[model samples]
Target: MAGSFHGLTVFNNNVHAQNSDSLSQADIAEPLFDIEKETYIGTILQNAANPTFRFDPRKGKSPSAFFAEVDPTPSAPGINEMVKPPTFPNVSPVAPDGLIVSSPGFHFNEQNNAMSAFQNALVPPKPNITISNSETDDGYNVFSKAGCIKCHAGSYFTNHQIIPADKIGTEPSRAKALAKTAKIFAEPLLYSPTENVPIRKNARVLKIPLNNIDEQQLRLGFAHDGKGGYKTPSLIGLYWQAPYLHDGGVAVGYEHNYGLTGTLLKGKPVDPYRSIIALVDRKERQKVIKANASLHSVHITGDGHSFWVDQESGFTKKEQIALAKYLLSLNKGRTEQQ
Candidate 1:
């Protein structure tokens, strides 16, 4: 249940960390006390002479803390800036048993700083050629009237809230698959960002704030609502993001093909307008649904989010077209509206 940088990590830790069977390739060259590792430093070198003196990082640590432990060089331009291989940084020369620090507070800040910088440097998408103020306004009206603003609200367009499995009505198994995430859920904690390279004693521990988020909503986002759910995403780049729904199930091709079987799997490019039309029109959705029937067992059926603007729903054909065009007109420099 996080929002900023920390929020994303929390989200990853929940649904991914528990069931991930993957091993670390990078953690091999360097090592730490992480749970599932082939080449952890703590494993490679241990004293066999006395069992008391040897330590596996896991013995004293909680599984909830960090995942992988990496030490990327903090500085640029050459040999001097390279990170020394992670050895027992806290091991004392004379202590009876050398210390083994948990993987959590070790060597993470510099790497996170690098990641933050890369993200900050990214540019927002520019307005597309087809976008126009009048058309965008028309689309906005249809969008609001159609009740999309309910969950896809706010300046960023996502309430960041989970739409329940029953409500989204797409695939429930994918969301329910994450139910085990709650077992590992813990408060997001870290050594303060300002700390030095070798984190010293008395390093400030920070608890990432999960403000404005409902605890149930947060848990369900990871839990997938007991049965599962979909988190509302920002509608910012709808300009060309096709195969519209979460499962990438709602697909409509450039030459009027439909579904994953007919489109993406067959090298047919998706058309943004037609895909959006299929997204809102129940009649077109049936075509997509039937086209994807082969994959329904694997849950790629283009189902759910039953909101519609088709003639059956009383909206005119012209209004439906306007809505599709308007969604694509986003980022043509129109300000974000709720």
Candidate 2:
């Protein structure tokens, strides 16, 4: 519940290139797991008055092409609250103002667009979420009976809505981490192509739509004033990734409890099959949480989402295992089944 703490709230970017690098975190298999998405690109692209970038891409050295406003002050004042495992290349030489490309018309956008298109083309269409026979008889019935299907509905297993921190309470730090960014967005000196002198008259700025966004949800999603929320991600690829939740605090190794450190280490793989059981079985989850605690992992716990598949929830251990197996077996829903 640290007010100024940010744990798993990272600006989502393509990790493909990062994974190949020797310096990257070993757990490259789990991609797109960060809480936030493309902070810099998300900010300047929108015409929102107070466009802010949280992490100063340019700090001790020259700024990156992506550098915007630099917030020199540390996020948290106390040394005890300082961010751990800091982002790389802390220093860089400052680049020219025009080099901070924020406009859609910037030359880099074409390459970005092309790369995006290529990536999209490379992604195969989502497979149908076909329930196996065993899953239909055992897991799906219990999952539905437990009312899990309400939020985790749809073929992808997500309703794609940002649930309020207060409502679906998990870790609050990451949800509230971006509250300061909203202030940055409101800064009149915010960096963007429009801020550049002799602004390009023909620049094609993207006017991001906010039509359907709920006001409360929007504010909550940013953790503005400590009331932000989190998006329910798709459960489609649960097999390939483990250590559930935004902070990845919930993790269990193949035959033992690896804790949160298991999340960072690619060598210690999280047994997705068992982890799902840990997720819904309260007793197993307690063991996982205790393991995560032993690692001194911050802002993460397998505590919330306590709709258990345990005896307390009138479910036997065998039923819980079956439900976990069913959950693990899920894939993208078949169109014909829909």
Clashes of each: 3, 17
Worst 10 residues of 2 by lDDT: 89-98
Off by over 4 Å in 2: 1-108, 111-132, 186-206, 261-266, 334-338
Which candidate gets the maximum lDDT versus the true structure?
1
Whole-model lDDT, candidate 2? Answer: 0.50
Per-residue accuracy of model 2 over 1-338 as CA lDDT, tens digit each: 10001111111111222222211211211122232334423333244343443334334432222233432222211111111111111200111010111223333222323444554344234332355686557877888888888888876678878787767757777677555434223211112323332234443333333445566665666665566788876666566667787667778887675566555555677777777887887778888777677544567676677677789989887788777777766554534334
User: What is each predicted model's overall lDDT from 0 to 1?
Assistant: 0.59, 0.50
Best by TM-score: 1
Show model 1 residue runs off by greater than 4 Å.
Answer: 3-6, 9-21, 24-109, 113-117, 120-124, 127-129, 195-204, 332-338
lDDT of 1 by residue, 1-338 (tens): 44236354333322222223122122222222333443343443243244533445666642212222221222211111212112212111110011111223345344434444566555457535385677778888998999988887776667777778888887777777546434333444555556654656666766656666676776566662466578887776686577888788999997878899999999888887888899999999999999999999888999988999999998999889989887765642235342
RMSD value for candidate 1: 10.6
Task: Report the Cα lDDT for residue 130, model 2.
Answer: 53
